[model samples]
Target chain A: MHTLIVIDRPPYGSWSGRESLDMAFSLAAFDQPVSLLFVGEGVLWLSQRQDASAIAQKSVERNLKAAAIFGIEALMADQSACQRFGLGDGTLIDGVETVTDLRVTMRRYDHVVFPG
Target chain B: MHTLHIVSKSPGHPRFLECLSMVDTNDVVLLTGNGVVALADSSIEVPSPLYALEGDIQARALTPDSARCQVIGFDDMVALTIQSQRVISW
Candidate 1:
């Protein structure tokens, strides 16, 4: 079954950001067709200049790159959310698709997750 | 401190990938409901102890009623957030 993972929280506000990623990788390992959607404050986690590791947190940029190794091919960023936040290309990780339209993708998945 | 790390998705996100790099393996990965789906993957490299919340068949495999599970919902996640030194939701 197809699954869509929704990430809505910011980088370090809560564990949702990390948990959502865990779920995405887990599903991908099982060979599920997984799609990742980033919305709201969640978009901040994708920025390229993030260096939260100094705060003793993991490097989100490196983690995102790890997803590709697991066979996950559907990382997506919400277009409107990005524009509203004034965060763009540099914020998102590599190998992620930017989705300006959400309805079509949301409807395609059998299971949709709100990871916070 | 006994920290609770809630994982709702697999393959992980950039922030989480960054977050784990900061955390030690002692922290627990709380996989609730749809979150339990994250645990089925053999590809994820996490060796952290994983606990599933209620409402998932997988949770039952871990424990009935998820008694051992770190409650992620059924209340404000922030409540538990205060109990522990931190709460990281991905």
Candidate 2:
């Protein structure tokens, strides 16, 4: 079964999003099919050059870079949310796909979970 | 229906808007907890075939419009979940 982990919270401000990312990695480690969908403020996690150092936190961008290496299937962002957040082709991190129809995209997975 | 979207956040929450955006015409929306507040908020445009938990409506003292939303008890909510091919809790 394909599991879709949806994160709608911004990174750094809360640990729930990070925890969700960790869960995705865990599922990947076990050879489970899992993909992540970022919507609302969660799309901010896909932005490039996020320097969390000043905030004394490890950058989520750095952690997400390892998602592919960890065998996570896909990293998706809501297109409208990306637009609202000003995340475009040049600003988003590499390998993140922006999806237009979220309802259709979500139905592809057997399970959908949200961060805290 | 294709999908059942369960929303527990208030209408003012960003996730509530996100949930609304993801709703398809064939999909059904169930309001629980703070989500039932949407029934009273006139500005929020809820989708058709909407449902609000009866307990939530009572707890919040909200009188949802009978025409616009169907109030369901726990058993009915479970039935709705079983009827849908997919369920997304937002």
Candidate 3:
């Protein structure tokens, strides 16, 4: 089934971001059609500047990269949300498609999994 | 059917309020992180079965004693991604 997963939290600081991504990756790893959207602070996971693994915790960056490798191509970041966080233009985060319209994209999915 | 709803944000964002407005006591609402801090407000109106940790709620620190539904740490506001489901965020 085609599943739409949304992640809008940062890494390590809290648990929502990592947990949600874990679910998304698990689904996609099993060959489920998965798409991930990042909004608010969630965009932090994609930032190339992020160093989540420095502390030995599960790395959001590594998970995102894994999701892409595992065929979870629906990774996206909210444009306005990026602006709100002062990450204007949201530093180029690998494996994420930054878009301006969240609601529209949200409506396109069959199953919306807020894995946060 | 038992449903556990976990939220990890304070009243910091409008989405948190939206997540709260979506459900009630029958479901479990886990508040952690900024969410644990958010609980201090008292007005959050979390529907019961509220399982929260003093820290990372998403990490699934506190487990609710129940069958049918399992407890998992949901990242901040990422719980809203499921279909036909309701969620609370920060």
Candidate 4:
């Protein structure tokens, strides 16, 4: 089954988004069909040039770069949320797809999940 | 309804706005826990066919506008979930 992991929380503020990423990576490790959908503040994860140095944390952008190598299907962001966060074409990380309709995108996956 | 969006976060929470943004006209929204705070928040424009958990509303000491939001009990909430084709808990 195709699993879509939804992340609606912003990065750095909490560990939930990271945990969700870990879950996606684990699923990909198992050769499971999995994709990530970033919505709301969660779209911030796709923003390029994230410097987490001041927060004493590793940058998520670096970790996200390994997703393709690990076989993760895709990284998607809500188009409207990206606009709200000012993440236009030039500002987003490479390979992330911007989807306009959240419902339709979600329905494409057999299973949908959100991180705690 | 196609989807029933259950929001348990407060109005200030990012998921609250995300849920509202994703809500379609045919979708129903049930506000639970801190989500009930949206009823009293004038700044947030909640979608129509909104329902707030009675217990949550009472706990928050919020009085929802009867014309806009219908207050529902646990049983009604259960019925709503069963009625909708899909349920999204945010």
Top model by TM-score, which number?
Answer: 2
After TM-score superposition, the amount by which residue B45's alpha carbon in candidate 4 deviates from its true location, in angstroms, is 5.7
Candidate scoring better on TM-score of 1 and 2:
2
* CA RMSD, predictions in order: 15.2, 3.0, 8.8, 4.3
Model 3 chain B: lowest-lDDT 10 consecutive positions: B80-89
The better-scoring model by DockQ among 2 and 4 is 2
Model 4 chain B: worst 10 consecutive residues (lDDT sum): B81-90
A1-116: candidate 3 lDDT, tens digit per residue: 57677776566887766678777778877888878887777766666666656787866666677776778866788888777766644465655677986656754655555664
User: What TM-score fits each model?
Assistant: 0.55, 0.78, 0.56, 0.66
Estimate, for each residue in A5-73, the C-alpha lDDT of model 4 and write its tens digit: 998888899888888989999999999998989888888888899999998998999999999999999
Candidate 3 residues lying further than 4 Å off, grouped into runs, are A88-90, B1-16, B19-90
Scored against the native two-chain complex, candidate 4 gets a DockQ of 0.19
Model 3 DockQ, alpha carbons vs. true complex: 0.08
Whole-model Cα lDDT of every candidate shown, in order: 0.64, 0.89, 0.60, 0.87
Across B1-90, the per-residue lDDT of candidate 4 in tens digits comes to 377888988988777776788888798999988888989988888899999999989987898899879999999999998897767778
User: Per-residue lDDT tens digits of candidate 2, residues B1-90?
Assistant: 478889989988878887898887798999998999999999988899999999989988888889989999999999998898877877
CAPRI class assigned to model 4: incorrect
- Tens-digit lDDT string for candidate 3 (B10-82): 6776567756765444545666566665544545444554555534534434433434223344453345234
Ranking by lDDT: 2, 4, 1, 3
